[model samples]
Target chain A: MSPADDPCIGDVSEGHILRAILARTPAAEHALLGPGDDAAVIAAPSGSVVVTTDTLVHGPDFRLAWSSAYDLGWKAAAVNLADVAAMGARPTALLVALAVPRDLRVSFVEGMADGLRDACAALAPGCAVVGGDLTVSSVLTIAVTAMGDLEGRRPVTRAGAEVGDVVAVAGELGQAAQGLAVLFGRFRDGDDPVPVDPAQLAAGERLALNAQLRPVPPIGLGPLAAIAGATAMMDVSDGLAIDAGRLAAASAVTIALESRALGADPARALAGGEDHALLATFPSDGPLPPGFRAIGVVQPPREDAPVTCDGIAADPAGWDPYRDWDATAG
Target chain B: MSPADDPCIGDVSEGHILRAILARTPAAEHALLGPGDDAAVIAAPSGSVVVTTDTLVHGPDFRLAWSSAYDLGWKAAAVNLADVAAMGARPTALLVALAVPRDLRVSFVEGMADGLRDACAALAPGCAVVGGDLTVSSVLTIAVTAMGDLEGRRPVTRAGAEVGDVVAVAGELGQAAQGLAVLFGRFRDGDDPVPVDPAQLAAGERLALNAQLRPVPPIGLGPLAAIAGATAMMDVSDGLAIDAGRLAAASAVTIALESRALGADPARALAGGEDHALLATFPSDGPLPPGFRAIGVVQPPREDAPVTCDGIAADPAGWDPYRDWDATAG
Candidate 1:
């Protein structure tokens, strides 16, 4: 297809798709300069900033057959924004670098752009696409950088959770893991990859699939929790249990979770990751804000275990990159 | 090495590496909270910020055989920092995403950290290595995102130069290209892979090789030129002839260069890329700064060419990503 004409829905080169996506970007108010420059320029209020980056490689992290380019784009931005949000900072902008095979379709690239726009719109106010480098590679890879501003507040850190702090979470937990399970058909045994009836998958499963594909990180909640006197905060990219263990270790405290208080399927909530949910610690005496649910408490380190649930020591069972998941399942 | 020997280095496991990088990062003074929680919070100084990202792939960008891990680390930081500098902004912080084979040595990873330390020390003061994600991949790749502070200064854009402006440059030119040429052994044709004699390559050639291995960008010069009243500016990553053409087109003007003024082997100076030098434009009548040298004049569009050298039209030549150097050479 000619560049002007939309290539068949999933059939255009990445370069052509990128150009199309760039063409649709609206000029944000605080953006002095956006895409096309060597780097983007934004108005920095306090002369200080926070920056973070992440990369997603095909095969290891995702598969194109199951994921649309738009989903990949959105996920890339979401992951980086989650890091910035974990810093208790408000995201302001992003830079994206993509490597794709030359034979890839332009439509796929456009979908990726759409996904990026959707994610940025939800997470960052006045965020614009900036400079990027495009190249051909054996596998598709995406790299994203997110920038944020902390408006003169002392940054809360993982080390700040003292004994007696209440642990709370803003946003859902385990949705992404459930979603991935549905997507990969692991939730059902001997499921056909191309089923005779695709509708056999439940609607709720579809929602989970969407969650896995496009995680909506709790962006504003980070700065909000900070303002509300959260002692510490973090984005739950890994499973809640694993990430909570990290917070406890960093703060040199023991954390006890009332797993029963967590929403349905507590096991999923404990071990499922990629939720992008905000888990924060607030002082026991502090007022808890709306939407934040208390699920645990911080205490002085006890014998052996750093984290426990319902008065019993809980195994730190979650995804381990080095281990085989299938073997563990059996 | 045992994890106890380098507590600061944290666990060498991919997961542990992610935790360690995040642990030492303190929240920005303006940060409401830093990494550890669901999302980070930052106080937007003016409710805006500029962002950019780049990825360095092994083999295509650098070879482990020729460059030390530290050199690779430094170069990665320099490239991203240069992008921020090119926008006439001061870099404030960075986020790095890394992928490597699991079999890689811990010492090699330490070298990368050292390189990051050195690069940040030279370029951005107090810039934090805030957050990143790590995963296993077949090859080593680094993704870096750099954020900058505009500090209320009007950003110098490529599109702002006008006719009759004076074109000037700050920092060294062609050093990286010269270094690259020597590294590829183009200086000595048909040479064995291993040099017949270790001392055969001159010290100057070795210096050039080092330059390519670890480019030292003139980070301060960009902001300095901006403060000194530069109307337009950019970091010279591509060759001067090609990048100058980009600036001219953006400003809708023609640029003329004085070949004699370009000191020594003008062709190399004009065609070499990766200098990371800042090329800028100012009002012709304004006083130029101490380190900047006048290189050309901006003029109204002429029938001859967009960029000309010493009254003669010049071809726009430099690195083209799609074209192989070997094929072009033949």
Candidate 2:
């Protein structure tokens, strides 16, 4: 569509924009009552629902020049889904709350809805957008709340790991962080962010870029791990070293990593974040689940550090919005 | 606390801020798993859970000069709870997503948590904040998702109203809008919003200001309406004329309102919004619910407007953020 065909969202009515978005949203499998009501009713066959909320803001969370509306929507939904999955639950529905700039086009909103639908279809089937709220703001923000069902199984928490448990990970670790490196190192024009040039990216870098833009965490493996007698589980969103340290602290144990198991770039794997890989602990007596690969072992709590690499204390370096985000640098 | 004690959130770690806020948050009655986890698990005893989301942005939604941190938090939770209540369900849990500026005070966040706790305690007694996400943003925003339980009763939707139903409301009308008017008319200094002066207000204005700042919608009366055999229900976030018209269009009926039934200021009652009053339609044969009073009667679909007052067409005027919000106007 041409610019004439794309009207500014501010020029239209809220209902008009909502209708366009609602038309793109798919029917949720677990919805007893869907949109166009005061609220939507989602089925909870397991007698309880696992829910989590995550937000993507314009500046600190993402840059518009680097991330498209589709990528933003997908990342927002994927991150929240990973949280629910980390709790050993099957995602059922998503409720999106969008605060968009009025100057943006209506098409951007439509693209976001499509992205939300496609992400759910690809990452966690049977889950879809059941309800949402839209309002005007100077900053473009997407906040998503995801709900899931446990399917008669108990939720796996980070505090469940025992000393003898084997620590394992599923999905990529350093790829998303590598993508961030690519964006910062090659795709910037002075202090401002510029769009990525696909031609400049190598095959590996392209994969890394995709990992950063739209992470497909091991969603199905969460329930699998729970069923396989896994003791602890959490998604690796803020690097393996930092997240592993969190798990260790929560469980009151120390985790010692095997450097060779973390792929060729062990340092990158330990420090890279936003890949949304599943980090879980299983009993040492049983075989690890099909998709998960053992990378560490839970040990008695040590005074030095919560996590260690090759018998040495590892740096707990990861993204912390409060300490790391600098609006001027972006 | 002294000025040195109340440091900016930018100086503190995310964990420090979270711990401060969590210390003030009350334990959710329906929570199987609460905060400090990847996700929260809320009990859905009736086999299904009702969910809805609403957002409050800094500029269009509120101004820091006028509303306190506590007011913002209370309003955010109260608004979302009203939506779930309108679905004829008892609220169970709330998941908050806060995108705040780094320069704000940690004490402000703790106050917000207290507001969320107090709002839930006052409006929906059993409900409390179960989980939340906090991120940095240029524009402060609060996005809340509320979940509720039906307790075996089917939802009372706006589409279920019949021609013979009696239109009723269970809360004050025009009060919030009156409060807004007070702020705009008296508390502003040119383009910027000035702090509200309580010493300059009368008793009625104080009440109106409180209504706008922290609305106490009749949350309990929602389930009561369902048990009282109400055919249709909705919360009047927009003005009665506009929201009633929406309900009429959804139910394929016309609403004939009695102006005499409305209190003294009928025009303000018809046009003002944000009161979040529970509007319902009950069978003409049954007595009205305890908190509700008759306002109008449902009629067959007409060629004219969806809503009428004193047998004449009533104008549908309400807040539409896209068209109504002007950044320069404050």
Candidate 3:
């Protein structure tokens, strides 16, 4: 049965809510131990674990009125899993802490669980929601901690990009930002005119909107890139320009982007955010890895200009969680 | 300088906030890869890892007016660490997801970092806050995921206790509930007449307040209990009656407690919450582990009575995050 047909989260006890979640999201293969225990045991094949955390708050992160519970859950999983993937690790387990208002629906929790499971099954096989905490709060928050296994591979960090490296990307970019733009334009001034169905839209429009609501980062490509000898890597949660600037700063080098290679609007690719694409740098002579295409080149650091596009400096107008961009835009 | 002397979280950029946190909490030994990267890599010496998560929301879980940021941080670490210890693992790493309002003081964030560091240094040496995500939210929330190493020991699960096992607790109880009582009585409504200082309260009173704020669970004792042949174990975040009931139910047995052995008021021990003690059962033939005193005995499953004290059935009155017991009490 659909979560909407179930009891409201507030109407049922926390125990019921947990049972619902567990019933839906069966334990994946890698989980030596799953939920119902004080803690979970997960295999660490390389005798190491890669960990990253992300949080999605209701207001600043997503508009509750626009995104479904399933979307929230998918985005939460996508963003966190992408972080683990960026480190050249195989996504393994997730520990979630979900807090919602008492008035929320039980179906929302179930949809969320389904989203987490669906995302894991699709993006990173064997990744499981091993354990989590649920609490009550005025603001809904989905906090996720993702752990990964390196399997004896070296971690690809942003600091290893050397001058003379080829800069590349492994997934779509500028789509989520374009989707958010459409969402804000469509639902402006609290006037919601029956949100447009993603299916009803054109291919590009559907991709954009879905990107905004449920991002699917190239998770599997991370370890592949590392094995293929990529030196520096990061998930582009921020705009490409901003994230690339971070890589440049970390590596003490300059990234020179070729605008045409991105396929999407060059400016949007540079400035729009949340597509969660994988950006990496490889040795100049090494072939670009599968699922990745060269988009730029790494050059000696320039004190004032860390990242540039076609020889011009690129602005770092990435998403900042603290900014009230919605208020101004709305 | 103290956190109180710092800037506000809202005024600075995310970069500045990250810098401050990284500066304050340096990586520990196990972090093969630490902060400044997309994710952290930690050594899992046991080839497997124990993982757990917990969330502390602003209004429901704590009152900022009463509990300092330092207290919140320490408690977050303790509660999650305790879960790992309950599984007979040595706490190794922590990944924090912090969400707070824009108006929060930067000093608060700093104090929280310090608190996390202090708790690790004091309670579980070598454990570190290797990575975290900080975001802006309407309500303050601290979500922590703790990872532990079992060192090749068998995980003491809650399902192994036999009918003839002896039940024991590894830490204090009822103190946190008592502290909450004092806080509620002292600062009810918006009156806020400067909460009682923990130092000024009597030793017993101080213990209660401190327990409510910065719970230092006996993590070290958990491993000892497991090594000494604990059959079943769990961290007592809920009151003894409730958590023990859960243990009993999971093990398909009943726990009969001796009121005199608990050294606290029977009702308080059974109903109070947030004490975060270790509740374990061992074979009756084996001696109680060091630092544990027998408080109960396991018995065959009783259809009506799941947990009893002094031969009288004890109701499970554990803290329910979904329930607003505070508003009713106030």
Candidate 4:
């Protein structure tokens, strides 16, 4: 049945909805126990598990009018997997807590799961959607917690940067923020969230919109960077300036980024967020791994500031959805 | 600062609020990496991890007026921990995804964390609030995912019951549902979400309300049951009949309850939900574990139904919050 008729969550029972979604769950080779029980079991043979959670609300995280359910599923899985990668662990399984409005289409749920499975298959082959909880709510919210296998290595935390270390990144820089800006501009009146098929858009415009709707972080490089002797690492989620400031403060060092080294768009590299790229600090003498490029250097702590670009102070203005909507409509 | 006047979330920025909450996080012995990073590292010495998720919406799951931040935290932790326990695992860490209205008080978040900490401390020590995401939403929703260490034991899934197994419970039954009924009765108009100090109520009434607001499942018994050899098990979140029917159906057997054994009020014992007690099946020749009382016996599949009470058919009409709200008011 089409979601528009008798297939919307509100019209169907919870049991009916769950069974439909279960039929589409991707093969979970790493899962010891899948859904349909009190809890799911997964192997943690590494003796340690890296864990993290993120919730995307309807208004603050995404607009259904702009994002298809497939994109929502992709984005949600990508965001959480990025956290696992940031820990220098291979994401192995995810548990999702989804709350949806009754009027939500059954297709919405299936498309979301399809996105989750597709993302896992594409990004982390062994990672699976192990278990999840579904409930009714006024808004569609996805809260996902991801677990990763460290494979017996020390986690690369955000607190290990040392003075004289070289700072580097291993994924696209600032494209998400750029995409968000483009979408905002396109939906200027804020009245329209639906966009033309991205395939029909100009190349640059399409790239930006895709970045906003579907973020693909380079997941493989996190573990590689750790093995390559990276001292500290984190995903660049809330802008480089702010998150770098965090790593610097934690490591008690100052980070100095060279503008020329940050591609043609230095400001976006410094201030844009949601790239989900790995930002790391490696010993200056160590080698930068493949897909990684040096962006800055860690300096001994300066009492006045923890981050800088060249010799000037760089403002770390990250995207804050809370503040964004607090001020006005999207 | 008190949560009321100067601590509303909107008044304080997200960074400021996060730091304040971070300052109060308790020590987590099982956590290799705690909050303040991209992800937390949890000790999983066992080769396996037990995972589960539950989402509590503001209006559907709870009301802010009737429940305090502390109660919410306690209840949330208790619910998820129970799922781990049902699987015969020790809950090791929790990742909370809290979405709240901007106008909510920072104290609300702190209090919720405090409740989380206190619950972990009092109920399941070493299970820490390792990491979480805080975002803005129109409603306050808590979606928590709990990870558990199996300690190298085979999980007690719901499909292992054998014919002639004895059905037993490890904690309270029917109380939470009764408590919910009392609260709904007291708040007939539903105008007052907040209730007076429960201590002022008669013991019976107080017990009912407390069961509804804060459920303290018998956590230590799950592993003990596994050690004692429970063939099958599940937590009693849904009513006994509904959940037991699940076990019976899963195990491909009939679970017949003997009314005389389920204390007084057999209806409540059979139909009430949210008790968070461990219901399990053990070999009839084996001894029932401590804290568990026999209430039924597993029988070979019966043609009439999967579950029955006193040789008569039992209808499973457990709590369905989705349907309740679907028909009417907030």
Q: Give TM-scores of the second chain, every candidate.
A: 0.86, 0.97, 0.93, 0.94
Second chain TM-score for model 2: 0.97
| Candidate 1 vs 4: which has more DockQ | 4
Per-residue CA lDDT of candidate 4, range B33-124, in tens?
A: 88889999988888888999998987778877678998999899999999999999989988889988878888788888888888787778
lDDT of 1 by residue, B170-282 (tens): 77677778877765664334431222233756787766676677888778777787888888888887788888887888888888999887878788778888777788898
- The better-scoring model by DockQ among 2 and 3 is 2
Give residue B94's error in model 1 in angstroms: 2.4
* Candidate of highest lDDT: 2
Residue A164 of model 3, lDDT score: 92
> Model 1 segments beyond 4 Å from truth?
A1-18, A123-125, A151-154, A183-197, A284-287, A320-330, B1-11, B15-50, B123-128, B185-198, B320-322, B325-330
Tens-digit per-residue lDDT, A99-146, candidate 4: 988777888899999988888888888898998999878878899899
Ten-residue region with minimum lDDT total, candidate 4 chain A: A321-330
Of 2 and 4, the candidate ahead on DockQ is: 2
* Model 3 chain A: ten consecutive residues of lowest lDDT: A321-330
List candidate 4 segments past 4 Å from native: A1-6, A190-200, A319-322, A326-330, B1-5, B190-200, B326-330
**Which candidate wins on DockQ?**
2
- Candidate 3 per-residue lDDT, tens place, A211-305, comes to 98999999999999989998999999889999999999999999999988978589888877898999999998868888999999999998878
Per-residue lDDT of model 2, residues A167-235, tens digit only: 999999899989888887888787678989899999999999999888888888888888998899999
Sorted by lDDT (best first), the order is 2, 3, 4, 1
True contacts kept of 2: 0.82
Report the CAPRI category for model 4: medium
Worst 10 residues of 1 chain B by lDDT: B321-330
Better of 1 and 3 by lDDT: 3
Task: Give all candidates' CA lDDT scores.
Answer: 0.71, 0.90, 0.86, 0.85
Error of 3 at A175 (Å): 0.9
Q: Worst ten-residue run, lDDT, model 1 chain A? A: A321-330
